[model samples]
Target: METVFLKKGEDRRLRIGHLWVFSNEIDTKRSPLGSFAPGQSVLVADCGGRPLGTGYVNPASLIAVRMVSRKADEVLDASLLHRRLSDALALRERMFRTPFYRLCHGEGDFLPGLVADRHGDHVVCQITTAGMDAHTDELLSVLDSLLHPSSILLDNNVASRDLEGLERFQRVASGDVPEEISVEENGMSYAVPLKNGQKTGWFYDQRVNRAALTPFVQAQQGCSVLDAFCYAGGFGALAAKNGAGKVTFMDASAHALSYAKRNAEQFGTETELLQGDALTLLADLRREGRTFDIVCLDPPAFIKRKKDAKQGLEAYQRVNEIGLDLVRPGGMLMTCSCSHHLEADALRGLVTRAAGKRRRHARLLFQGFQGPDHPIHPAMPETAYLKTFLFHLPE
Candidate 1:
């Protein structure tokens, strides 16, 4: 009901489809920051009092306002949330064979700061912003009205909430959430803990990328396969099932290795799980002169922020070199980075540099991206984050 008048030229970004409004762009003279509370809906207007849209306000954060609707009269309420949730659900139902996938991808779904990962009858929802956090009850009601899920677990234990001056906590919004849930991807079922697993129980974005490794693994039957930073052995298990032999999984988490072993055994395949720092393990493997026919480097974001670019780029180069060293001549390399700041070209360039250092020629097999569950917003380049590249290195 309140109005947020932007500075004379501050509406340019909004006009270009950008949804964020920084604290500095507000016309504080006309609209005092202290007058509005966090998560409070307000009408956004231009310099001449022309209505731009509607969104929620967060005075304590740098991204003071996030546009929720482009329509001048659209309000932030249950009706709006229902439409967004329904639209997100409709698209996922059409794309996936089952209900297990990312149901809502925050800003990508136009519901900024809210994410929902659907695990069949159970759903894990995360609200990272003051706006969505304020509508917890309404969101749960709407979700129940649509899918009528058995459980709606609110996994709000993320660091980003702190930036908005909001404390983080996790609880079941409705119904009882089991400790572990089964999610099927690419015809294989994986058990992930709802409360303890990383990033909404599983990295559904890499589902397609894992499938991409199958044909390559099928081509090299009974060949050695290495999965670096292999959490739960998604790539390794898929490769093994597709005919890769002597599969090895490396991860820092002993618990993750346990799950990885289970997933491998479930498919009647024997896997060697190594627990340690990935880089150190790679160094030790290289010292032992071990090589693999297929290598997957699916590491976490080396570059989380812009300031970490220099160091992160160096780390990417080092990891690629280690992965290349572990791959036999003419072997395949599946390298992925979830860092939004790392561009596809930059990742390829790093791989090229690593191969050049060894005097090996690199041939790109194919470029892969996150599955359709994680849709990209045309206006937000940041939404297009995941990059998976399959390469062949010739000695």
Candidate 2:
């Protein structure tokens, strides 16, 4: 195996358990990064030539090295893949009652750049790293032999592939994938469009947060509810099924609205699906003097890049303020942010600022992270990104 030597003081992150080794940190004079091929396993050593760990080197990317195993003697092979997959499945079985959940959550599960989500007998896998991409055949074989998933769908359409110098494509890696699959969450059924849906067809990360809204929802029975950015009607359908008098789902995607309608129909709940931009729709609702008993704000990542942090935070504050304004006095507001760039404290501050701007006293009733299916790595704070907070508006 080849070796990539780091300069003095450059292995600090690796020692501290952070997996990424940037290209700039390498000792180019001793071993030029250009010589290494993408996804090639190499022995990483410190300045004194002491072995550090076994990792894959991607010279074309900024994240030059992604640690595969800390054990010096460990080899990256089929046996290792089997062990990692089994360990990941064990954790999921212990945490989730149903088989439908995030089976793997990238670095959080100690398998960097690999995500596996299971929906019944089907498994949707996404490989976001060159290292994982290089091992697709091994991964597929292992998954087939071990899980025997009815099908394995590759949803590798993420833009992150560009940064890794990879081309993005989607295909069924093994077996046959059905047109649509149903997965139940918190007693609600949803039809997931795996072949052409967002982020593996469903947002399983919000399962716990959506379940947490049951209490607030039950309390507001027979009251009108507004579910903004209601993808597939997870929140809106839940509210309606929980006995909300009525539910209105607003989103910019017509396809998402269609899925939301289908979900509502499956639950036999009456829902009003509106297709449009959330911010514009909210403004119109406020102008029309519309007020809902429960308003849910589950928008997409407002801050995708670090440079957009400021403007994105402002956008969050604005939407949250609109959501608060649309709620009747003493109503409930369930707001969420999936932006890893925005910390929980910063999001709380945004909500506080929104409440102050609206001149309404907001009392936080509940706060939560992503569902148990998406476990957080102690060393990788970025893995724990989702934040949902429920608030009570003063009457």
Candidate 3:
């Protein structure tokens, strides 16, 4: 393999276990990036020519190299993919009784740019980077061998693919893609639209956080819930399964609300489905003096890129302010942020400030994160993205 030498001192993060190598860090004098083809596997080395590891290089992307293995000779092949799948599956099996969790979590599972979420006998994989996209066949073979999944859906329609200079499209790699798939979580069943659904059809990362809502729902008699940004009604379904008296499903997408309504129907829970912008609907609800026993705010990433941090924080504050306003005295508020740019401390502080604006006493009941399936790489903070906070408003 050709060698891609990093500038002196640029190998520090990689040596400490980070998987990404920025474009500017490369020693272009020794190994010009333009000379290598996209997704070309290369041996990374320091300026002195000492080998660092093996990874695939993408000349067009900011993350020029994503190290696959620490060994110089190791390559991302069928053997390596098989071993990584086995290890990731082993951990998930130990953590969950059902085969309904994220099987591969990009860099978290040490397989950068590849995410595979298993939904029963079906596995939906997202290959975001050109490097992983080049190994689609090997990935499919490894997944099939490991799980024998009836279908392997490739949901490559993501914005990140554009950054990698890869075309975005969705296709079934193995068996015929099903219209929908069912999976049990927190003793509740959800009908996930695998083909047209968002983000692998389900967000398994929020599994633990959704499960944490049981006790809160059970403790309140005739509980009312507002599942804001309710995708497929995961949160509202859980509340309904636990005997919530009234559950409102709200989202901007009519497509998402269709499945959320179906899931609610399956749960035999009478729900009010509101289709509109979350902020607008939330404000209307507040104006109508509508209050609930539990209000869940699981909005999409407000801060996608670093530059959007300021505007995203303001957006978060506005939405959360309305969320807090809709919570009655002695009620619960569950808010979440999937933005890696927004830290847990910042979320907590923002929520605190939101509550203070109403002169309400807020007690943080629980702090939650992505489930074990979405393991956080010790050296990569980006891997630990999801943050959840459950707060109680005292009377």
All models, RMSD in angstroms: 1.3, 1.3, 0.9
Candidates 2 and 3, the one with greater TM-score = 3
- Tens digits of lDDT, candidate 1, 1-395: 88999999999988877789999999999999988999999889999999889999999888899999988888778998899999999999999989989999988899998999999999999899998889988899999999999999888888899998888888888888898888898888887777788777888999989998888778878888899898888898777678866789999998888877787777667689889999889989999999999999999999998999999988888898889889999898999999999999999998888888889999998899988889888788988999999998876
lDDT digits (tens) for residues 201-285 of candidate 2: 7899999888888887787678788989997888888877787778899999888888887876665567788889899999999
Error of 3 at 27 (Å): 0.9
Q: Model 2, stretches more than 4 Å misplaced? A: none
The TM-score between candidate 3 and the true structure equals 0.98
Our model 1 lands, by Cα RMSD against the true structure, at: 1.3
Candidate 2 lDDT score relative to the true structure: 0.86
Give the per-residue Cα lDDT of candidate 1 at 147: 94
Writing each residue's lDDT as its tens digit, candidate 3 over 1-395 gives 99999999998999999999999999998899999999999999998998889999999999999999999999888899999899999999998899999999999999999999989899999999988888999998888888998999999999999999999999989998999889788887888888989999999888889989889898885699999999999899888888888789999999889888888777677889999998999999999999998999999999999999999999999988999989999999999999999999999998899888889999998999999999999999999999999999999
lDDT winner among the candidates? 3
Q: Which portions of model 3 show Cα errors greater than 4 Å?
A: none
What TM-scores do the predictions have? Answer: 0.97, 0.97, 0.98
lDDT of 3 at 122: 92
